[model samples]
Target: MGSPRAASSRSRAITEVCEAKLRMMGGSLRELESGKAAALEEEILRTDAKLEELGQLADAAARDLREDFEQAMELLQSTRRVKEHMLVDHRQQLGDVAERIAALRSVRDEGVKACEAADHAEMVSFLSKHASTYSQECWQLLARPLPRSIQVPLDDIPFEVAKRRDLLRGAQCSEKLARMKNEVLCDIVDALRQERSTHADTREYAVEVESLLEAYATEWEKRFDYACSYCGQVLEAALANEPYCGAMPGRKAHHWVPTDTAGIAEAKETARPQLPVAAASPRLKSQAKIRAISPMFRADSSV
Candidate 1:
């Protein structure tokens, strides 16, 4: 009975030891699982951080690309506008030149006709006889040698009357030629003045458009940090002193200047006077004088 009881106690002790070992093994397994969970959590956090960093980098890259693309587009648009203005200006110049050429041809034709009329033999012979007679009279008055004058009645003069008629015709033709020449000269001058004015207007408009485009580009560039993507330099430094560039200096906010359009219009209205219809030439001359003096008074009063 004592041996059996000792054997039973030994078996119980072995069971207790086995149970303790199992508990220890279970605790170690729990510790390993906890460590694995912590490691996985840390890995997840690291992956999230890496992804956030990548996202930030991607956003920055996208912003830079967008900025660059916008700048390129603005430059292209500016170039296109300038080209269009130039093409229009060139076309206008060509048209003006063609019109001037036509005007010159017309003037040349008029001159050729006048010259042909002046070269008529009958007219020339009549003018020559009058010239001889006038020269003789002039020489006699100046106490110089005079040719012998044929004394004949006016109606009985055969070639003398014809000579006088030819002289009158030559004088009339000369006056007509002079008037035509003056008209041609005036037309040419007017055409030149118009061409010059048009050219000036075109240049002014082109400059204004270019300035507007540059101002827009400048404002857009300032929003993108004004940095050159290619050279990594500050774009402001590159464009500080440049008159025209893809990126320009930003304009400071300014107060709007007041316009005097209404005042000018009012002043013009007040100064402008109604004129009476000129029935006589004297009244017309008086009106002209009044008009000329009115401008001076208007200028002084406005000032």
Candidate 2:
């Protein structure tokens, strides 16, 4: 009985010891789990902080990009407005040139008509003297209204009809005269054409010059509301008022003369009064007085 009781006690003690060991191991495992959980929480907090910082940086970058974009947009808008204004001005200049061309064309047409009439008159005068010499058929052919095709043989035509001695001479003279008249007419036409061409070229050049001036004027106007017509002087409204008389005050005042007010006053003070014209003497005014004086003066004369 005693041996059985000892064995039972020992087994019970062993069982208790095994249970305590298991409990200690379980407690240690629990502590390790808690430590791992704490580490995981800290890692999560770090990740959250990193994400917040990234978000802040991204927001700042976005803000900067937006500001740059806005500035670029504003610059583009300003450039576009300037271009549009220039286009409008150019259109107006072109219209003015067109009107000038139209006027020039009218003048050119009148000149052409005048040249043609002069040529016709010369031809009629030349043909009138030789009217009776040619045959009826030849006269009729000459009279026929033809399109600028009258050709006189300069080197091979008769000079006279009755004797027919030098028939080619008259024809050659007529041809030479006709050629001279044609040359004069052509010169007139060419001169008129050249004048018109020169006028048009001048107009185009002026328009170009005006366009460049207008561009400069626009730029200047944007910077300065009022400017000198002769010089390019830029000033703000406030600064412009500082010296209201001159466009650029620090430099020499153009078109302005310094007047000496003190000298003018002194000159005015020194000026003398103008004298009146002397009247005739009262004794010589009357004829009786003049006769009396003459008699006294003639006492020593014999008469």
**Model 1 stretches astray by more than 4 angstroms:** 1-29, 92-303
Q: Give TM per candidate.
A: 0.23, 0.24
Cα lDDT computed for each candidate against the true fold: 0.60, 0.57
Candidate 2 C-alpha lDDT tens digits along 1-303: 579989999999999999999999999999998989889899999999999999999999999989967876676676667666766676676666566556555555655665678877655554563334435534454465433322333342222233233657778898999999999999999999999999987776555545444553453334223434434454346544443335445664333221344433343453311222224322222333333544422324321
Task: Give one digit per residue, the lDDT tens place, for model 1 in 127-172.
Answer: 5545456555445445732334333333422343466689999999
- The clash count for each model shown is 0, 6
How far off is residue 129 in model 2, in Å? 41
| TM-score (C-alpha) between model 1 and the true structure | 0.23
Candidate 1 pairs with clashing backbones:
none
* Clash pairs for candidate 2: 157-167, 157-168, 158-167, 158-168, 159-166, 159-167
